[model samples]
Target: MNDKENRSRSRNETSTRTGMGASRPSRRIVAGHTRPCAECGLVDWKLDDSRGEVSCNSCGLVVEENVIDPGAEWTNHANTGVDRSRVGAPITHTLADKGLNTSIAASDLTSGGASRNGISARSRREWRRRRVIDERSKTRQSKIRNRVKAFQYIRDRSQLPSSLKEEACRIYGMLSDEGFVTGRSIAGVTAACTYLVARKEGIPRQIPDLAEKFHVGEKELSRLIRGVSRRFNMHTITLPPQFFPKFVSDLELPPETMMALDGLWNTIEPHTDIWQGKKPMGVAAALIYKAAAEGGTRRTQSDICKVANVSEVTLRGLIKQIDGLLKSIGSPSA
Candidate 1:
């Protein structure tokens, strides 16, 4: 039988045994079918056939019947089980007991739902829906624009490189097959693909020029260029402008000291039969210093003696004669 019939029969049996007119069913009679009361064992009950409610007549507990509860799906629920029916009037009575207005919804008086948390669940759900809709709209618009742009690029294949042109032709074929004729710009597509292939082939092409020709942003063109360059293992040298001048200068000689004296000279004249025996060649270094002062060449006689590999006295005698010879030539001794 349905639950109502069974409950009615059970109430009748209880009233007959007690010899009372009251139709209250005990807890044991409706073990699995009815909900429990913590204060007493089904103290008093009223089952409404019209409304289908199991109510307590003693404490005025009126529970709605046939309500599916969330907790019942679990294997175990302590006290607050899912099968427990949601009652009417008890909520009103409870609020009344607390001297509160019973007409309002349970959420309204509870801190406007803000004192409990940041925001109400209803508002949060509405916000989430709006956000989802906005995101979806934006995504759809972006996709449509990109597709149009790509289509336009494919139509103008003649101006692009062979590889890029072929790709554009292929894309155009695809678009035709897909039944899309007036989507994007062919000129724009041709330039983009041409620039990309140039970068891939290690040829540097400026984006602004391409942008002017194809009606695309220079920034966008640059991004595409870098992407293609990286994919094709091509690298561009970015040396500073000043580095070239410095490199060329390094290869040229220093004209100021192009021929500087670097070796040492030592007089080692030995004894010879046809000449005087070996004698330590010596000269006053002061005389060589004085001769350099007279020559006015900014070089001291000591410097001359060093170059000639001779003593100071020999250097002075040679300097006097060299000075006269230089005068004969109308030039100062250097």
Candidate 2:
């Protein structure tokens, strides 16, 4: 080629590559088309997912702005972030269908003005029929139907938190899978699982309380708990005496009464005779009553008994036992 033609071709190539007149090379480019920062001369660039920018990490300068983020847009406040995800509620074992089943609403279709594109009476009837069929289909399997009923009972009757409910449902499923539910009633197994989970999570619900709630005999429920514990190799731990302070506080006792209860627990905890084979709730109630009386809180025996759900007789018995122990230790009695 001629020298003039070669020079023109080189200039054209440089202009195309640099997007500018061929005066100098572009500073944004490096070896093999790598882009470096114009401010700090650094190759390291960070993509800000939140702000949608490519910024220089060292110089706090944005190398490129308005970058598109290929992630879900989310809003976070305080410690919680709202997941505006396309996916629905997470799969949970508590539901018979693991929460994947869709629901058909039976409310008035025209309630919302969007239903101005009205449906005929015949279509409405067909939808109602379809809703019935969907409902029936959910309980097509006997076991699944039983699980649904059991979950409803647990939720309505147990008054447990959702976390404990989910855990109980999981435990029931495990028991059913292991053939532990073959001869056991669904209610019994579910109640046992709920009690176990409450104890495991330290939520403070007692076996007798759950039994009374479910209308199952306390002896029967206790038997089921023991059986389930053995079958699942579950280790049940007794709630410590330290749990009494919360119970005392829940009784609406004053802070001084709570402090007095704490001191009483520390003094009497070494004496198991005072609480041996006794319900922790009863022991806690007795201690609270004693502490309140000592602190001049004017809480009556009947009042303490009602809050603890123990009889007045039991309360007096526990009080007497605690009072004796206090005297033996040379501590003044309430």
Candidate 3:
């Protein structure tokens, strides 16, 4: 062969051996890498921690089955027995310590359940001293001590749910940071926070209800609510009229009466001009009275007005407006 032809043949042979001239694409090797599924040729693969398998997302093909997982050995929750998680309880803002502080049980036995009396009296005394120290440590800071007291008062007085209580605590924390709680009564702020959270959550709690429960004046509660709301720039919308159904049910009203009231509220909902700028509770009371009267139920206007904490005059005015609107729409009252 000629010298040029011989060099060309050698170059081609070297390219083939090094896979540079191969017809098929070469696979790249990488540490902790994923490749396309052999069965479906799909590149999207998910690592299943429970089964330790790499599966195709498109075809559900098991690409690489039974991989060893190098994650933690424990889980937060399990179907069997108690959760054997090595982690502690989740952090909560409701507690003064943010639920991170360790609590020492006041039992006769040690933390490991060993008999305390079996140990030396000196050790028992030391444990007691440590417990006292731990408790006193929580109160060393005036802010923490005040938070503890405020939270306790909220717990004792408010009948709020746990989530609402936590939210109230968070709101109070913000208020304290802004110095809003410096001169204000802790009870008032706590009550106002609870009320605000309940209202935001669509729970049927009134400001006066919270004030009465927490033994704070309604004006003070209102002031705190306004201050916290403005400081946080929180604009809570008014509760929907649909909330009245669940509320009226608490009064032991008949199902038919509730149905009528629901219909009335739905009809008047779009016409916000009628009930706008009025107390929702008073409007709801009037609607219930009108619905009851139209539904042939015997609930007196006075009974509903008292239940709604509205005056008879206000109730009558709303009833008249609703009646006129219904008549204008060519619908029967209720």
Candidate 4:
């Protein structure tokens, strides 16, 4: 009986191993699943990359087809061995048409160029008229016409860099589509979006600056900003540190002042009462003036006020607040 038991155990162990005594099983995972061909029991398959198909090699049964090719495109313009390539600029929201339209070239309609193309005077006149109609047709609709005008206003008046302008235009477009801009001033919407984007991006500009540039009322701009922020579910909190870099760059303060300015903020941030109710721009301007003085690269209050767009009286109050905070904390006043 013991001999029979030992023989049964040996048979079980042999069955657990594959034909070659390998521990792994013959089945393999394919496309996150295991599927055996109906005609052939073997799992062997071939992938035809050019044809975008996967077929069982044993039975010629197709398992998958029309697979997308995931590969980079090489321009190969010069036909050289190198894989040099170029791509067009990305679509931008700042343009009403997303900058994808092809305009008829005015140069092609000129005298010398028109003659080179073998065009007669009669044809040239007709082509010129067609060009005008084509250009007008792009913005012929009310939506497109309004967008063209609004986007151009943003580009010209926002004074933001190309990136910020793009973001502002994108937000404005979204609001316009959702009927948020209906019965609302375009300049006000553009200004609000600009300020919100700048603050979110960490280089905030005051609402007054944006309003003045866009010729929108300050109260209306503020209200629009709040409405847009709520609609988009975006939280925008402006910190004094976020305004430091821009003020420092504009005033041309030394890099040493940066460390001092940061130190001052770290000292005040923990004291909620001191900073909680203060305006960010006012606090930032005060810190800049103080830091510059401490660093021996002094800038007057007038200079800081001009750059920060804060009145001297407001700046003085912020300066006093910062001084009191530093004194209480036993930190050196900067």
Most lDDT-accurate candidate: 4
Please give the ranking of all candidate structures by TM-score, highest first, separated by commas: 2, 4, 3, 1
Q: What lDDT would each prediction earn against the true structure?
A: 0.42, 0.73, 0.74, 0.81
Give lDDT: candidate 4, residue 274: 69
Question: How many backbone collisions does model 3 have?
Answer: 0
Estimate the TM-score for candidate 4: 0.70
Q: What number of clashing residue pairs does each candidate have, in the order they appear?
A: 6, 0, 0, 0
Over the stretch 1-334, how does candidate 2's per-residue lDDT look in tens digits? Answer: 4755754554445435444555654334312325645554445456766676767654667766767655664544354666544466679977877889898776753334225538676677777788889999889887778778887877787777888888888888877767787777777778898888877876667666778778788888889999998887776656336456566666676778767777888888888777868877788888887778788876888877776678888878888888888887898653
lDDT of 2 at 8: 53
lDDT of 1 by residue, 309-331 (tens): 35567655644643444465454
The numbered model that scores best in TM-score is 2
Q: What is the Cα-based lDDT of residue 316 in candidate 1?
A: 59
315 Cα displacement, candidate 1 (Å): 59
Q: Estimate each model's TM-score.
A: 0.20, 0.71, 0.69, 0.70
lDDT of 3 by residue, 242-302 (tens): 3576547756678888778778888988898888888888888878777777777757877
Give the 10-residue window scoring lowest on summed lDDT in candidate 4.
24-33
Question: For all the candidates, what are their Cα RMSDs to the real structure?
Answer: 35.5, 7.8, 9.6, 9.2
Comparison by TM-score, 3 against 4, better one: 4
Tally clashing residue pairs in candidate 4.
Answer: 0
Model 4 ranges off by over 4 Å = 1-70, 74-90, 106-125, 159-164
Question: Model 1 — which ten-residue stretch has the worst lDDT?
Answer: 260-269
Please provide, for model 4 over 44-153, each residue's C-alpha lDDT reduced to its tens digit, 9 standing for 90 to 100: 56777778887876558887898665667557668679654445445899999897887888898998989999989998999999999998989777878888888999
